[model samples]
Every structure is written in C-alpha cells, then in structure tokens.
Target: MPPRPSTKKPNSNPLKKKGPENKFQRQQQPQQHSKEEETPFDNPTNTIPLSLQQLLLNVFQSALVPNTSTSQDGKQDASQRDAIEDEGQLDVKPLIQTIKSHLYNRDFDSAFTDANEELLRAYALRWSASRTLGYAGVFKAVLGILSGDKERRGAGGQIVCIGGGAGAEIVALAGVWRDIVALPTDDMNGEEGEGEGEGRMELKVTAVDIADWSGVIRRLDGAIRSSKVSGSKRHPAPLLPDGKRDKFSVTFQKADVLSLPEGELKSLYGQGTVMVTLMFTLNELFSTSMAKATAFLLRTTDVVEPGTLLLVVDSPGSYSSLSLGKSEEKVERKYPMKFLLDHTLLSVAEGKWEKVLSQDSRWWRRDAARLRYEVGEGAGLEDMRFQVHLYKRL
Candidate 1:
C-alpha cells in the first residue's frame, strides 16, 4: 500500500531536522521543451533578452547531456558503464533542494560536489537571473553618472564579484559593457578609445567564491562567447571603435573572501575603475560571523584604493542576529540587512565608505514561462524583491 500523508508542522529551520516526506510528491515527467520567442537584444531594457536566455538554456542542455561514444573495441569504460541520461530524466528538484538545505545549514563545502555542481550552478542562475539583471541595471545607472566624472572614470577597469562564482556577475557586467559600447561616442565621455588597446575597453571579471565553481564559470564564459558568434543575426556582435570584435574576459577564482590577506586582496582588486559586488552574499557572511564580516569590510577598505565602487544586492528583509555583552549576560537582537551594512561599512574609524545609493526594496521580474528548460512541474521560478546599496571608498 502507498504511504500515508504526513501531519507534522513544517520546520522553521529546514536544516535542523528532516521534514516529513510527501507521499504524493509531484514528478516532472519528461516533456517536450519549448523555445523562447525572439526579442530585440538592444531594447535598453533592464531584463535579459529572451533570445539570450534561450542561449543560456541551450548551453546548459549541451552541458547536461554531451554526446556519448564507445571505446575502441566498442566497449565502455567504468565511468561510461552507467547508462546515459537525458535532460528530461534528470530530476532537478531534489538536487536543488539538497543545495538549498546545504546553504541553509551553512554547509557550503557540501554544496560543491561534482555530482551536484552543474545542478547547483543551474539552479542559482535560474533563481537569480532577474537579480543579475537588476545588478546590471544598477551598474549601468551608476556608471553612466561616473562616466562624466574625470577622477572616477572606469572604462577599462576590472569588476571583482565576491561570491559571484555562479557567473551571474559576469553575465550582468558583459551586458553593461555591451550597452556602453553600443552608445555613440559623445555619450561615453570620450574615454572609450583610450584604454589598453585602441578602441578596446577590455572588461576583466573575477568571480570569487569559497566553492569550486571553476567549471560552472568556464561553461558560462563559453556560452557568452558562443552567443556573440551565433546568436540573433539582427543583433550582430557590437564592434569596438577600431572596428574589431569587442573584448570581454572573465575568470573564476576559488577563495574565501574573509580569509584573504590585505596584499592578496589588493592584488585581486587591481587598478583603475575597480568595482566589487556582493549579491546575496553579504548577509551570508554576517550570518556566519559578525566579527569576521566586520574584519572583511575593514580589510577591503585598506586594500582597495579611493574611488572604487562597491555594489551589494541581497534579499529585502531583516535576517541578521547579533549578540551583545558577555556570554552570561548576552542579549540577542535582530537587525535589518541595510542597517547592518551601514553600521559596519559607514561607521568604520578609518577609510569610511560613502553611501552613494541605498534602496530599501526594489522588485525585479522576468518572464520565464517560455523557457526551453523546466526546473520541475509546479516549480516555476519566482520574481525577486531585493535591497541594493552602493558605496564609494573614501
């Protein structure tokens, strides 16, 4: 006989203990995937174009199921002994849930297994695509203003994304650069053609995370480059001032941001128009250890030069717990994310960061109904509501 339904109350902390099993679990049966409807690439919209989203899906699909081949004697090796599986048969919900559980439990190391890396990365990309676009929007807005400032011009500088190894930051920054170059010369403050190479405003992105997300970032880089070559014909690759293909380079560095020394961190920051991003990342650090987080901010300030920009995007809500006084007389308090960031970064004794932009809440949505890949039946992607804070080092 089939198992009966569970009657226990849902656990507030999913990581604490296992929840009751759902006997009537919904399964995502294999179904035909649909393609995204084409849309103009240069529409000046904050969201990712449908065609580009489709490209992401295509790249993910190819990675999920590569062409299989037999050995020399038509025999399979131990690795290939297991039968290959198609995308449809790949149960993504459990993998996603596992990742969520690991993250909730602060077990980041467990989330980086080879078996689940692709799925983990895919889930993150799908879950935060809108947030990524939102980041791009904020960057574009701020850079447009900074472009006019002679001292803060960051035309050919690097963008360092702490905890952005999922490659969202890379995609967003690439989009921003594309939009910038597509503009007329007069709008770019005439700094476009003065970079390392003539007419080449090279963008270097480094995605740093504790997890070994090198494979994921590598795949994403390939996909972005591939899209430029074979994507929508209407939107041919944008050209540099020298009439050459625009250059956007990205690399993945696996490291713990909180543990990096000042000199190493400075080297990573590089020079000229440097920007650092902490999308859905800062809160995690605070949650882990307020002391460590505070040290990280102080260390960052000491490393990065003045005029560097720091952009942080995270879920809009108060989810931080702070402890005050000694252990016996300790008092715990819950603080809002923005307040924590402000209190830490703004209240620093030396090298205080100037608050450039702060928004309590901002909504971002994307229409993923037409996507070629489905996460699972009844597992549609939800829109994001986040808070954004931008700062400039003094």
Candidate 2:
C-alpha cells in the first residue's frame, strides 16, 4: 500500500525537544518516585488513553485466569491469596450492599453509568474521572487568581487534591502549569513577550486516597513525558516560555480522610498557600454518618494557615430525612451546605477564611446562558448536584 498523504501542513521551523523521556527521565528524578513502589509505565502500549474504570476492569479480568503452574504448592499459594483477599473484602461489605441496592432499585438516575458491569467494578474505578477537562479549566482559573499570593507572582506554590484518583487533578495542574509558563502573566496587561520567565514555577500535588492509582497516573505521566521528549510532529507536548517542560510532579499516598493520623496533616502540607480539595468525597462519606463526615471536614481545616484555600465539591440535598427519619431507616444526606451550617464550621469561621466561590451545579445548568463554564460532554446535569465552594483563610 502507498503512504498516506499528509493532512497537516509541515512546519518549516519546528522546535527541538531537550528534556528527559519517560522511564530514563523518571529514573533521573529519584525523589519523585521515591515514595511510590510501582513499576514505571515506560512502554508506549501502557500509555493508551483509557478511562480508569476500563484499565482496572482489564486488570480484574486478567486476574480471573488461573496461573500456568497448577501443582499442589500452587494450589496452596492460591488458597492463601484467596484468604487474604477475603479478609480485605470484609471491610467493603457495606459498600457491596450499597451497590446491590443501587442496582436492584434500578436507580440509574445517577450521573455515572447504570450498567451492571460498571456497578460491579465501581470499587476500583473512579466515577468522577470524566470531569477531567472541566476541572482543568476550573483549576487553571483558580491558580491564575491565586498567582498574587505567590512567593513571587505566578511562580511557586503547591496543590493537594483529596481523593484524586486516576490523575484527574494531576492533568488539571499540568494544564495550569503550562499556561502559567507559556502565556503572559494574567495580571500583566502588556504583550505576550513582556512577562517572559516571570511565570516559571515549580508545582507539586499530592493525591491522597485508599485505592492505588499509581498505574493509571504513571501511564499518563509517561505519555505526556514521551510526547514532550520526542518533540514529534505527529503529537507534541506544549512547551514552556523557555522551550522546556514544567516540573509538575504528582505523588500518590494511601490514606483514609476520616481517620488520618494525628499531626500527619500539618506534616504533609506545612505552612504555605496549599489548596486542599475534598471533591466528591464529602457526600460519599455522608452515606455513613454525617457526624463523622463533619469531623472529617473539620480535621481538613485544622492543618492550614490563615491563607490556605479549601475547595469542596459534593452533592446538594437535604439531610433532614437522614437526621429526622425513623431510628432504623437509613437516609444518606446529599447536601454540602449542611456541613457548612454544622456547628463545626463555626470554629473555622473565627472571623476569617470567608467563603469565596459558591456555585451550585443545578443553578449553573438552569441558567446556562449566564454561565462561565461550558459543561463537558456527557456530564449529566440533573443527577449530579455538583456544588463547588472555596474558602480562603484571612
């Protein structure tokens, strides 16, 4: 067969790449991978752009097949493995029940998929992964706004997203870092070239969650690195003002938000303009107990200084049914405001850290004509009561 004709016009003066490729470069930066124990996603095949659910589903399907060795020792080892897995499964029994209720009730009204397959694999997958682009824009705008609080304007800071599985927050920070370095300073009114090198900064983000998201995140980071390293005409990574890639590193840690160790919060964040995000997790926590959920919210606020930014996203509905319903009947609350109005927030409001951004998803959709953001594709509007809030300590 003959070679296909080129669709894109060839550039006369293409830029050359002068950075590290995926595995080799990753090896050079030992501190970045020091905390993680998983193998690096070096191969191109591992970098395919698949959703977290699909990747984990493939992992599960692969695990179902028996190993090649079928001797008596192998059988014993398999039994031991099964016993360990069963022990872990005991903790998720309640979650299994919830999945059963959702499926049996035929309540496909949620923004996430209604398929039985999806329901079964929900534990390993990230249900909120589809909001990648939307969150990227939101975080970009936010970092732009916070540029002033910088150690230097538009240059240095850190971002931490709670429950940021599958690298959604990583992608968002990467987009923001690139824009910061390439584009002129947002506050500067001069031409593009005026603020050159002013926005170059180092950013670090920590994704805290119980499930291991290293595989998917490594795949994405590897893909991006490969794209930048090749400087290929086929697919190129966006370059910074200095024609270099930004050092936006993402690290993952296994943690339970509600029960994080005492003082671990302060040790992790330190004293800086750290932006802590509790997206999608608050409402999920409320499924069990609002009191415990409120405790989780309070503990998050305890670590930050007067200027730390707290971003929250969750469903919005009255928890009155949960609090006021029969003693035996279970009612899971959906409102973020309830957490706000709870007595716990009173401590946080010590005449400081006022609420800044408060936008309900329903309100945005209801009045789309006057909205600031274009809802991403297939992001169900009605089912998700996606409310976003930002509080900055004074």
Candidate 3:
C-alpha cells in the first residue's frame, strides 16, 4: 500500500520548515551537494583489503578480456584459462571462472578432473565466501523461528542443506543452533522454569552434497560436537554431537540430490519437521539442463511432507536458462515466477507447499559484501545476483 500523505498543516506554529520559502530550508539548501559515484577501479567499499580487491579485480580483467579458450566441445572452456604456470603463482579468478563454467554446466567430471582440490578449497574460502555474500542474516532469520514460537522451540528439527559446496552455509546453520543450545533457560522460550528438557528432539544440521570439499568434514565435525549433551533426546546419547557412533548430530552425506536415497530421506523427515535449503543449486542446475533440473525438483518434492520448511535461493537467469542473443540450434526457456515453488507444491506434484516469503531484489546491496549485482540493464557481462523464495509444506 502506498503511504498516506501527512495530514499535519505546515508550521502552524511558524517554527518548522515547510518548503523552499522557509528560513530553515533556505539555510540548508547551500549545504546540499551532489555525491560522487564509486566503482571497483576508483572508490570501492574497501570491505576487502585494497590489495586483495585489486588482485581480485585484476583476475576479472585477465579472465574476461579476450574471447578466451574453447573446450573439447568448442564452447568456452572457463577451466582451461591461464591461471597457473610460468611464475608458479596462481591467478585464482581465471581458475574460479573455469571451474564455474564446468560447475554451472553441471559437468562435474571436467569440473573436478585433475583439479587442485586444495586450491579450489582455498578459492571457496577466500573468494566465493567474500565475493558472493558474507552476512549470516539468513541463519538468524531461521533461528528466529525457534526463538519466537513456543511450539517450534520444543520441536527441534533437521536442517538439510542441499548442494552444500564447501559447507559454508551448513557451518553457519550449525553455529546458530549451537548458540541456541548453549543459551540459558530465560533466553529460550517458555516459562521461567522451562529448559532444554522441554524440547524432545535435538536440532540437527546436515550437509548434503556430491563433493566433500576440503575442511568441510572437519569444520562440520567441530560445529556438531558443540551441539550435543548426554541423554536429552539424542539417540543413544553419544559422547559428542558429531553423530560418529550413532546418528545424533551433524551429518555430511556425499550423494546426488537429483535422486536422493529413500532411506536417508525417511530418516530425516520421518518423525519431525525438516528444513531444506537450496542455496544456488537450482540456478546451476537449470542453467545446464532443464529436464534434469525439473527431475531434481520433483525428487525433492516427492520426499517432503506437509510442514516441511524449504528455503530456495536462486537467480532468474539460471531459473530460466537466460540467453542474451538468438540461438541457431536451440531456444532458451522462460519460466514463470515461482515456477519451482508452484511445481513442488501443486497437487499434481504431491507436496502442497505454502508460500511463506517470496521476494525478488535487483541491484540489492548484500549486507557486508562489497559487490552488487542487478539483472537486465543494471547487470554487467558477469555479475553475482540473487532471488529468494521461502516456503513451507501445507
């Protein structure tokens, strides 16, 4: 709704400024000035150190400056870009772009073939995390669920992160629960006497992915270890929350989400509410192949029951396989808004999901991240952008 105009009459007391004619308004007019625009080359956010930002910016120049190399299939081979060699020093932007081309194409074989696992790990740590996003606002948003609602606080559920590369968000999810579990009684919901004992099931954050990136398992191990105690609803009450001896805490599963195993799905969604996060997965998948992408979404829909929480974060370009120019052999597909959500929730698809929050932002300023991206005219040849859809099964 548009805001209602203010009803107050201007300066009936004659002390307030009403318009340009007012003394106060005239006094302030001279102080107003036009602001200069900033760019990566000149004025930057400087959230990232200037030296590192320059290096990162340089990588962009080195990668996109030319027509670039072609793969065996005659398409742009982002992976084979000149990132290493003569100086024995690495220019990571080129390498990241290459891996991304393969990754965005969903070609894991070429993406990981002879790839320096450690370097890729380093790239995720230093580049993807910083360049893409830094804020854990989403985690806090999720955690707020358990904080505000008394019914939800006692029903700790499983957090399953699909396509959890490097497990960055997975770690953040666990961290939120960790702090939640470590909270004092008053901090948590319920009357003054209510405690952890009030909750029957302990919260679990699981990282599901095809590739187990470096530091993922260890980092998850630490995060999970901090979320458990003895008897309080944990199965068999393991010594730690790592879920090592038994299934008690965080789990890292190496499996393709397109056809997830039924046994694992049942275990996760069998008795309690299950929270699923699809972070940039649909974008990458749909960009490469639409049929496979639909199949994957269907598979996820098949598993979820009513009351399941799903958070989908993707790009419209990927969601629709956006092509800038006309293609000779094929045409790009344009999906309707919330296409994924509608399919997953429609009666024909089995799961009936309810839209909780759906927002599309353009040139949105990502909190704490220096970069900004917009679709259409505002976007560059390459820009990191996002659109979000939050849902819950009916």
Candidate 4:
C-alpha cells in the first residue's frame, strides 16, 4: 500500500550484499593473507631455525652494532646467549650426516668447493673483526712500552711480528706510531702547548712469510697509502746519529719460516732498532722441519743487535684441531702453543735471546655456544690466546 517503498529496499547494490558465502570467504581471507605475508625466518627454506637466526643476528649486531643506549641490553643479551651457544651440547649429528652424505654421494669436487667457500666466508668475517680489535690491543701495548722512559733509552728496542697476514696489524701499528710521534705530549693530553722538544724514533719493520709476494706487496702498498692519507708525519729531517733515515720503513721478504734466507736476513735487518710481531702464522711455520724452524727463531736474535724488542702473538693450539683435523692429511702438523712456546723458549735461550714478556695462556676464548648455534654440531671453539714474548737479543 505504501508503494512497496520498504520492499524496494533502498536500492541495495548486489556487490554490497552480505551472503553466507561472502561471510565465509571474508573469514578465510585473513588467514590466506597472513600465509602470503610470512617472513623468511618464519618459513625458512633451509634447516636453519629462527632461534639460530636470532643468535647469528645477535653476534653480528654485537660485533658491528654501534654502541647505543638501546643496544646496551641487546649486547649483554647477545653475549649471554653466545656463552650458552658455546657449550658442547646441542646436537649437530644430523647436520654433519647431511653434509657427509652430500659429499660422498654427489660430486665430491662440488661439495668441497661449496664447503671451502663457506669456510672462507666465516674466516673472513671472524678474522676481520678479531684482527681489528687485536691490533688495537697490540698498539696500546706498543705505546705503553714506547712512552715509558725505559723504552726511549734505546734499551730493548726492536719489535718483531710473526705471521703478519695482510699486514693489518702493521698498518694499525703505523697509525699508532703516527699518533704517538706526530702528536706533542700536550696534544695527547687533550691540550695544546708549545710542542715538546721530543723527537720521533725510527721504527724498522720486517714482514716475513711464505705467502705470495704479490699479495703481500699489495697489502703493504695499501697500508702505506692509508697511513699517508691519515696525515701521518714523515720522519723528521736530519737523519739519526746511526745514519738511519727516521722514516716509516717496512721491508717485506718471501721467506719460509722453515728455511729462512740467511743472506737476505743479514742485508735487510743487520742490527738496528727493531720490533717484531708474529700473528696467526706460527702453526704453519711449525709444521715444517723443526730444525729449520728453530734456526729461523735463532736467526731473529742473530740478525738484530742486543736489546732489540720482539713481540710474538699467536693462537693457542686448541682450536687448530677443529680446522686442522679436517685438512690434516694435506698439511703437516705441530704441537699447540704451550709446546710451541716451550720449544721456542729453549731455542731462544740457546740462541742467547732474553725474554722480557711471556704469557702462555690465552686472553680471549671463542664463544663455543654461539659457533655451534650457527655452524651446528661438528664445529668447536678455538682459543685465540697468544703467548706474547718480548725478547732482547742480548
């Protein structure tokens, strides 16, 4: 009677209708949308779990994350988690089995190729960070020794570095030299004054190893360029009384620790102020003929004058088992740091070199739990401690 006004139903559009099927579809849509939006962590294509991802993320963040207020708690949390990850627990049998099977069944070459890439990647990451921090530690020690009144007396003067890889430590030490020698003590103390009458000392560095000559040269060139760009002052004019130009000079030679070149040794560093550093290279040197290796150690003292300073930094032998065991068949082996030190000290003593500093224990331990969490079971922690020895040629 009212012209069916209500029955016409406000001209409802079909699209706007809420039918049973529409309601059912609407209810299902959210679930489908959620599935499509899943994150890689949630649906990882590989066996790596979310917890492990968090752990790795924590490690990277801890190492590289710039310090900030919000990050303080994170840093602590990451450290604690890393400690747990370092423990010997947590099963990796399955992962190892998977890898072995893949290696044995598939083309062995491909499998090995992949594994090597992964290994290199891991080493590069860890070494880059550890080396940077470690170099900082070394430079701090050097400055402490250099700044002290005793060091300036030219008593116990040469610094020796073993196993100088990529020469990063050398670069860092050069920077320290620039900072110490270039800056007046007043500048170091955060105040400017009439520059002190202090003069810069001559630092003669010798880098020796069995690595490719080209690679070593490239690294040295880069380091020198970097030091120059950072505004390092060239050694002051008027050569020292010893007739040695007081410039930053480094001589690189290709010498195997096993059979060092005696002639080259005499020509490059025949008695002057020197400092020696040995890094991650001792193990390689040790595996060679012990007699030859011992001779090299003896020659270090022989080549330098009495009271030269020697600093040797190397990893403890514990971690060698992890990586070395895998490649043992291909490479010769040697004892850990303790044994190496015992032998080295005996050799040095026989060679008449006096030891100034010797620490057999390691200062840094790898977070085993974190490594296992990332690499899974077969992986173990490597102690990065060094038996630092400061020797005077005597």
Runs with alpha carbons beyond 4 Å of true place in candidate 2:
1-129, 150-155, 182-193, 228-235, 238-246, 316-343, 346-349, 362-385
Tens-digit per-residue lDDT, 1-394, candidate 1: 0011233321111111122212231121212212342111112233344544433433333333222212222232233222223333445567677766775776666765333565655455455444455565566665454444545443566778998876667766665555554332222232334332223355678889887778666655654554222233322322111232245678788788888877778778877637888988898888878888878987887778777788887776647898999999999988887777776776553235666555555555455555444434323445555666777776
Clashes of each: 0, 0, 2, 21
User: How many steric overlaps does candidate 1 have?
Assistant: 0
TM-score of each: 0.70, 0.56, 0.54, 0.50
- Candidate 3 deviant stretches above 4 angstroms: 1-108, 112-116, 131-135, 147-149, 179-181, 184-201, 223-248, 261-270, 322-331, 347-351, 362-385
lDDT for model 3: 0.44
Comparing 3 with 4 on TM-score, the higher-scoring candidate is 3
Each model's lDDT comes to: 0.55, 0.43, 0.44, 0.40
- On TM-score, the leading prediction is 1
In candidate 1, how many Å is residue 110 off? Answer: 2.2
Query: Pairs clashing in candidate 3?
Result: 78-98, 79-98
Displacement of the residue 185 alpha carbon in candidate 3, Å: 10
User: How many steric clashes does model 3 contain?
Assistant: 2
Candidate 1 regions off by >4 Å?
Answer: 1-91, 104-106, 112-116, 146-155, 182-200, 227-230, 236-246, 349-351, 368-380
Candidate 4 C-alpha RMSD relative to the actual structure: 27.1
Q: lDDT tens digits, residues 23-59, model 3?
A: 2332232221123422211111222222222222222
Least accurate stretch of 10 residues (summed lDDT) in model 1? Answer: 9-18
Question: Tens digits of per-residue lDDT for model 2 on 83-140?
Answer: 1111112222344356556646645223123233223233322233234434544565
| 1 against 4, candidate with superior lDDT | 1
Model 1 misses residue 11 by how many Å? 33
